[model samples]
Target: METKKTDKILLFKGIKLLIFAALSLFMGPTLMTMALSDKENSLYIPLLIVACLICAMAVFLIFKGIKIIMSSMFDKK
Candidate 1:
């Protein structure tokens, strides 16, 4: 029973990492474009800041996920 729960937890973590990676991959580029567009708008600065933050966060999450997955894989052996 405990082993089953552990397997489920690991599966959930793997899925979460995958989801984060996908979101980061997709949002990072789109946000970069939006941030660089030259349009006179009131929300430009705020949006750009937000985009920067999201990009940073996405990067962090991706690295973290990769590290976790790699460690888990090696641990299996």
Candidate 2:
């Protein structure tokens, strides 16, 4: 019973991570382009920072999600 609960939790966590990673990956580039555009928006600097962070987090999430899935796969009952 405990193992079943843990496995379900881990699976959901992995799926969540993958979904967020995909969203961040998609959003990061678009934000970056906005940051680099010639438009004179005052929020450009902050947006640039956010874009970089998002891209970094996206990469991190992908690795972490894969790690979680692998760990769950080999976890002892």
Candidate 3:
């Protein structure tokens, strides 16, 4: 039987994605809270929009990271 080996470069890419996702996870909620607290301010709408986009990006990154990590570990060459 042949031996299986993990793809180190892809694995590292996935790790990087996870790290960015974690940062986004923290930032999204914080921005949302700020936007909510200052609803009457001119920046409120813009802040809310950005927070929603960042939150969505974080979720996408999490799933993409896991998929990349799995592919790196299990894909057959």
The predicted structure with the larger TM-score, 1 or 3, is 3
lDDT by residue for model 3 (5-76), tens? 999999999999999999999999999999999889999999999999999999999999999999999999
Q: Please give each candidate's TM-score.
A: 0.68, 0.82, 0.98
Cα lDDT of candidate 1 equals 0.70
Model 2 RMSD in Å is 3.6
Model 2 pairs in collision: none
| lDDT for model 3 | 0.98
RMSD per candidate (Å) reads 4.6, 3.6, 0.5
Q: Name the lDDT value of residue 28 in candidate 3.
A: 99
Per-residue accuracy of model 2 over 16-52 as CA lDDT, tens digit each? 9999999999999999998999458998899999999
TM-score of 1: 0.68
Off by over 4 Å in 2: 1-6
List ranges where model 3 is wrong by over 4 Å: none
